[model samples]
Target: MTTAFTYSTTYLLDKSHYIETYEASVPADNSKKVYLIAILLALVGLAVLMLTEINAFVAWFIIALGGLEVFSIRFKKPWWLARQLISKAANTELTLTIDEHGISSKSIHVKSTLAWTDISKIEVTENGWLLYHNDSKNYLSSRALSDEAKAFLTTKTQLINALAI
Candidate 1:
């Protein structure tokens, strides 16, 4: 069997795609530290409120702080992504190419190529796939690709899986 696989497609990098790509780059942590901390903060605030009797300023402040922490955890990533992309790259036409060597992405705004070695993970999402790598991520949308090309990715995934074993 031939080992060479080359696929190329040009697609729009809109707000939703951008957000999804970057967000997936964050490793899914199963650790409960953050949740525990938030809960502790809330419980402490509740205790203070009960002991202080009838809505003390300090108790309310603690509660609000806990709430703010939870809010930050939920919104921080998308917010940061928007800031990074809002100025110029929020919407653009992106042409992506994948071969035996690496992945190359070109756009009206930017041009760059990420080597295959740079790709740490290939996550198949509902819409397409997320290419997670060192310090950067790339999103591949199925809108602009053919079934053959998508199948080629499946082959690559199998190769990766085999290597993992």
Candidate 2:
């Protein structure tokens, strides 16, 4: 179901981590494009060096500049974690499905089942709920959820607490 949510501290943390992980994992495609351009420029510089009696110092400078561009372009920050955070905020899915197929968004399939038992601990923070998964050090932020969604989650939390009691 479509749920409107607000950004909270937990959401920000999860988003930051997700973005950092994603950024660290994959190099940006733009960097590749820039590297290609740098290589082309270097080739042109080489040709110029061959044709003209370019000063040795100038030739070396050109090559070094091109090399620097290529290096910088090849190494770019990954934004997977930020992407995940934004994706969740942008998405209307309210429930995270955990089943035999693994974790899936509720928007994808209603048949997907989510069990509360999957989480290691659930606690309410200053702004939202922290859902710590059993295996991962990362946590899910319920801060981005709308008031209605928060209420629903609160009830679920209460139910969980009651069961524990």
Give, for candidate 2, the lowest lDDT window spanning 10 residues. Answer: 4-13
> For model 1, which pairs clash?
none
Stretches of candidate 2 exceeding 4 Å from the true structure = 1-33, 78-165
Compare the candidates by lDDT and give the number of the best one. 1
Clash number for model 1? 0
- What TM-score would candidate 1 get against the native? 0.64
Per-residue lDDT over 28-98 for candidate 1, one digit per residue giving the tens place of the 0 to 100 score:
55576766767778889899989767667888788888898887777777677768677676678878887
lDDT per residue as tens, model 2, 2-27: 54432222122344444444443343
What candidate 1 gets wrong by more than 4 Å, as runs, is 1-5, 19-35, 45-61, 73-87, 135-138
lDDT of 2 at 48: 69
> All candidates' lDDT scores?
0.74, 0.52
